[model samples]
Target chain A: MPRRTTRGQAAAAASARRPLFAATIALAMALGGQAGAQQACEVKLGALGPMSGPAAQWGLAMLGAAELAAAEANARNFTVAGRRCTVSVVSYDTRYTAEGAAAGINNLASQGVRFVIGPVGSPEVTGAKPVATRHNLLMFANSYAKNAIGPQWPLVFHLGPGPSEWAAPIVLMAQQQFGMRSVVVVAPNDQGGTDIASVDAEVYRSLGITATEEYYQRGTTNFAPIVTRILSSRPDAVDTASSPPGDSGLIVRQLRQAGFTGPIGHLGGPGTEEIIRVAGGIDVLKNFYWYEVVPTEDPQVRAIADEYKRLLGRDAPENTNMWLWVVGARMTLRAMETAGTTTDTRKVAEALRAMPVDDPNVGRGSWAGQRFFGINQELSLPFGAGLIVDGQNRGVRRIEVGQ
Target chain B: MHEFWSAAIIGVSLGAQYALLALGFTLIFGILGVINFAHGGFYALGGYVAYSAVSGLGLPYPLAVLAAVLVTAALGYVYELFVIERFVDDHLATMMLTLGLYLMISTGLLAVFGPQSPEFSFPVKGSYSIGALRIAKENLVVLAVCGCAIGAIYWLIYRTDLGRALRALADDRQVATTQGMRPRLLFPLAFGLATGLAGLTGALVTPILALSPSAGDPVLVTSFLTVILGGLGSIAGATIAALIVGFIEAYASVYLGGSAGALVLFIMVLVILLARPTGLFGRQIRGA
Candidate 1:
């Protein structure tokens, strides 16, 4: 009993010291507060996108757009309040994977960045947004498909028009112009199927257009069998939602090579140039239609295109390129200068949600009725149409008919 | 008719890849009593090496292919000397080791090259048409390249001194040793030959197909079944079986649905096991 009592007394002594020790450390930290914390105000921004792999091209484009927006803010020296302020953008690579996106969001959170743009592609945005919510990071990207982004807004700002928004227009055009009633939607099983199927069903039904949906493996080279099935069905139009411009180019080339003449369209497949290059020329993939959200060479875009040529020694896809991230970074710098001193994430996030995308580098309308930097809590995706042509690098140069 | 013809040509081209893959396995199984599950990695490595050699090294496509063959053959030699040779006579050990090596090589490839498809450019242009039917020139090239490979291999194995050594080694390793035949030296030579064939196939076909690290997986499976249906150590048997398998799969996939390759492979295995347990060319290599 005496020994037990002694042991209990010893435990009581240690437990009593734990909180006291913790308080001392806390008091010391309070006494030694950061010297730079006296600054007026500051906000943090995030530049998130796939920095590697097949989708890296678009991811960088999105990042560039954000940077350009951020840069404009720094130049103007706009202040949110009496406190001097500025923007600081922290960039992270998602690698276009769900897990990678989540990790990116977490890393941005660690840097106190609350608003994020990019991570193009629907699946990637979907995966990253939940992580954003968990960490209070606002998210948006132009690479999202239609259904994947909208109607789930507030926290998720879609930087491009949803499927119902973009493809609905195309399907409507097909019916009105070509007098087509029946169509076939061919897409890869995972990436494009869900959105394309839903849009094909909803939009075609609304237009009194009949449509069939066929799914194939993404890496499939011999699309002859699938082509045969579609040809037999005798659909008025054949719309393919395949990405990897290389594979799509190959498939289309094969179809034509095998003499399957028909109207072909691509929603948003493959890197624009790589696909064209792989297809050898625009001859095979000509007349194919696609959706573009970013404005092309509209002075702002023109300057960036010129710079890209100087930097990368080549012309990049004006809209599909990393315009958003560049704009985001620039906007972030402005937010930082506007906020003045110490970095405050909440202030930066609010500034980020308010900045516009009107730079001479990115799209003028990647947001709601506004190009970019619209102060709307609701984010919007930019929407435009493109026609694949047999031009410089088999690109989709014509955004208009008969041009 | 277009579908039928395209599918036939595509299937034959795919089967030729299978034949190349199968020949490698059959050579080892026939001569060394070992089943290698790592053949696909050799095929994948061959393809990636060929790609890098052409694009990164700035070498001509043909020279890149030759380089790929030589490098992969050397890889095969090292694989035999350090790994396969140590566990040569042990079937279970060899099987497990090959599986481990397969995983290692695949994961290593993923780490090095990443998980995206590498696109290869076609060497030539346009297609040839017959009457109302049209076919890709690339597919025809696939057929020709694979055909020439098989023919060359057939000649090398059936009508050469090295072929005699391979047959002699397969029949009785102990007796072959008594006859002054060293398998240790000959093993690398045999592996180099087999792996070189697979490498050539990879180089030839990458231009027409989307090649990832796992691209060779389907070809490897078909090759295994082909060799099993043909007799072990029978090059002629494997080639004929490959063509039959190719045509049947093509007919089934085009006319029917996606299960044709699996279904035909099943039927071929069934018939070979039930009717001719020793295979179609079982008697060709009785002593070897």
Candidate 2:
């Protein structure tokens, strides 16, 4: 490194790079430590997720998936570089912040990790992707925001469909299967709300259906009057894309109790647990539907679900946990194997973008095609949506709806 | 129609909660001339202790709540002897010290309990119905507790010798000292009574509201407004103010179609202050 600088500025610059260098040395040691135990080629991948915070539940699930995949691969004596290769993971917490994701990417890059998976949430992905690009590392992101796309976002692959994309199937389902016309769409007036409204409005307008949209803040806890006004609108369908669960559950329960027996659909992951837990479980979710990107009814889904129960020592939450982890690790493992190289980041990235990866979880359709659809003019995700038919009597059933 | 009942029920329940803490604030102000800002801390701590007993020590829910109130009431005596006893004549110091105490207790609790909340399950279920209008069973319990606290306040302030001393202290701490009333000792009694009221309120509300490290902010604000509206010195007036604030918030949430519950409480406070100045029940300060 060449430096023609003032003493203070040069010292600070050197000091800043010190940690990066140290992190690299430590990662080298970590890689060397694993390599010493095996005569195979090896490389480190970074597991980046929010291991704490409100979304820690989702983050931990991602970690669990990565660990399980690594363990399975190691046990199987994975081959790479014409020799056995063991994948080593250097886990970092995104802390669910934009700054945290950027920091994680920097730290992971310094450690020589070619691929970094994680730091979920649209904001974190947006923040981390730039850091990854700066370091020229491949980012296998877990963000579900459709807006988290474009040429500006390069080498960042989404493991799931975007938030805006989740609304399409529900809107389509309402018009086709349920034959619903007018719909009351209540969403928090945040970024999440803005995205869902765009898709919902377009779908309804195209179908000759009127969608009445009411925006509330994400922090709102009260929902009684909002629910009443919504009911007064007398829509045949209600869609709540509430970030906060208490209001969503309260509104839905009140809407049902008020005898608005129309087809009710929640808009996100909050519709799965936060709503269900607050509403006192399955009894409250009767005849309710929501859109998801993954198929919940496959034999593989059941196998994972059963494994989740064994791991957690109880019937696991219907939509969280193992699903987050496995899909991420599943993508990583297959891509690594298909890439057939342990040394090349670009080759691994190409494998990630390759069409027809044949992941069973993809359900007859593939996310490989559109993996990063808008991300960096490459790696478009297979963005789609589905329905989880979780009602009172039959428990929560996963119905595939996404293409 | 649902709006009316939902608002009414919500208001009454919320008011009952506000009345508990406000009653404590009014008591300390009425006697010590110092606002026990730490009343919220006591309220929060009492909830934590009761929760610990029921879950941590495996005690029954009612027993945990009872133990919590008693233990918190005792701490009030300790606080009075060590802290408030030094600031009896200085109202400004009293408020400042109590506020400091509030921060201390809150920080201490944060250190001990992480931000993740503990869940408390209530044993009761369903509401009692009178014709078409139904009241939730848990809400009914809060009402019952509020009623008891008010009745006890009536007995403590008007019916007992201890009550006479308390009133004497309120009239003139210096004169009360001359009249063979020991306010140094009575200070603890007053503080205990005020804090105990909040402790009991916390224990009572724990089952209904999820307990978080910072659950006292909304309650503290509500209590302040309740005291201001009820005239700050009149117990019955505080109860009335609490009910009004409660019902109005409920109505706002149900009929107004917005998150104006907190705003409604403040507006009512502002209106009452503009109208009455000294408050509905507060006594004007006499020449020292």
Candidate 3:
């Protein structure tokens, strides 16, 4: 009678295990389906910039920042509309030329990249815009040119704090911190330089500061003669209006060597660390100021800067326009997620337009260009005016300008 | 008066740097009847090598400069032995070869050192103010070093037996060969000395101006103009033309802006060529 009871109990246990085995098989199939879905979803991002020429530092930094954002997104197993997605960037060197820009855009288009970033200067953007329009690709232009963005180039998005927004703050700082009256704006002899310098002069005039404009050709290495001439005028402050990072560093170092002890400023360039490295050291960069989009003190920004240093073994893109590109990358991914498709760029563009301003990477950006480019496609944001004190970027104050 | 004096002093100091670069170019051309497009590559290499010695190995600045000169001199010797000697007789072939060598060296430098400009503090600091004119202490050091180097080069070319052999070979390679002078050995030695001068100049100016892979480009262009204006193979003429170009650039930049300064330089070159095809101090080619 005990053996019979044992057999009946074994039968009862086998009957009870059937539902659990079925449930386990169902769970495995579901997970395999999700993994397959994730493996199938991939987004391609293209970046066009001067990656190999004289202006390569800017391109490398911008490309590195965008790639970093995409890598971080992929690490989190970034999902779009219940499908796991991966992001990758394809980069082409534009050589900082118009013809090069057109070639880069066409190359990226041929590679089937629907979204693009950069072709950074005004002339490059103007050259690449038509090719981008022809391919129906969305472009995130890191340009300050008023003519580069509008309703005409509907797929192009201008990423900024444009010149008008940043120039006044620098002038104000020069006036308030140094009690400066007269200023000299040293600009490159290009469209970008002329536009930035003109805006600077207008701001200086409005602020009642005597402003003198000086222009130098691009690729000028020797600034001693120019600095001497600028000093001869005896301006209270000298502003490098939209010079490249290397040029700005040369200007400051030569100015100091020429015994110009007044405050110096640059409207736009790379990060403070790059300028410092190029200028030799903190001793040469004394009394220097520039505009930055991200405050160095922000915890998230600090984290990203630390990661960038760890990866690149340099402190570039710490507080540069690279941060703006990073923000644009994140916004691009967010738009793709909201639109629920990576291929439909029109929907993604609309989603980017409707993106909220309260993002942590870039704080409170608005649609700009209504006054300048005849459309509100440019994304303008609040920027910080930073002073280089003992090789550190000390954020002085935030400059708020509306669209 | 202060502005004028300042500009003059600045021009002279700038001229000194240009003179050092031009001397090297003229030396190579005088010895080897080929215009070495690779002279600029040697200049850039010297700066980068010195930078590595100082920044990577933590050597003293002077020691680093010495190391750079030795390394570049060795490189020049090897380059001539392996590459330049093959096409010495054909001007066009040698020109193409040197240009290829320049591209290779510059591209290799970019790969190793990266695109960012490298910076190191100048050993000397502060400026001396004489009335309204201020001169940096570093500039004085540059002038002194260049003067010594130029004096040494002059002595080497004029006083020594090796110098006599070089001049003999330059005048007539067949005659020099018949006189028991080995062309193979003398060519490498002359090339090495010329590149050593280039290396030394690059090391000296690195602290003043930032070092980039393309840093040698402007120096190459300016050196070409100097050698051309000085009549190609005339060291004395190159020295004088370098100073004139430097002063003109300084003044033109001040008066007519930066681009105008370069434009003025090109214009000066054109006028000089039009006026004197053999250059101000150039002698007629013996064979021609």
Error of 2 at A135 (Å): 9.3
What's the lDDT for all of these models?
A: 0.64, 0.66, 0.80
lDDT of 1 at B208: 62
Ranking by lDDT: 3, 2, 1
Tens-digit lDDT track of model 1 for A1-403 = 5545577898999899999999999887766553243242445567776654445556656655565555545556646544445655678777656677878888888877766776676666667867777775556554434434443344565544445555666665545545677777776565444555556556677878787776665445556566655565677767666354545666666666666655566665335555555555566655555655444434554576566565445554433545444554455455544544234545654565677655444544434523222334333434345554333223223232211
Q: Mind giving the per-residue lDDT tens digits that candidate 2 earns over A77-146?
A: 7776445777778888775667888898999888878777676666577778777887877776665455
TM-score of each: 0.70, 0.65, 0.87
- Tens-digit lDDT track of model 2 for B1-288: 654675676677677778878888888887887778888788888888888888899998889888988888898889889988887679889888888888787667767864334545455655565544445676677778787887888898899999988888887777888889987788898889888888898888755554545556556777887888887666777888888877776676555444454466578779888989878776678211
lDDT string, candidate 1, B25-122, tens digits: 78877777777787777787788888888889999988988998998889888888888899788889989887777778666776787555555666
User: Clashes in model 3: which pairs?
Assistant: none
Q: Give the TM-score of candidate 3 (chain A).
A: 0.83
The runs of at least 3 residues in candidate 1 whose Cα sits more than 4 Å from the true structure, single-residue gaps closed, are A1-119, A123-156, A171-182, A197-210, A234-237, A305-321, A324-360, A363-378, A388-403, B25-64, B82-120, B154-181, B211-288
Alpha-carbon deviation at A259 in model 1, angstroms: 1.5
Candidate 3 local lDDT, B1-288, one digit each (tens): 666777677788878888888888888888888788988888988899889999999999999899989988899888888888988888999899889888898889989987777766678888898876788899899889988888888898899999888888888888888999887998988888888888998888877877877777877898999989988888888889989988988888887777787789789889998999988788778421
- Using lDDT as the measure, the top candidate is 3
Worst 10 residues of 1 chain B by lDDT: B253-262
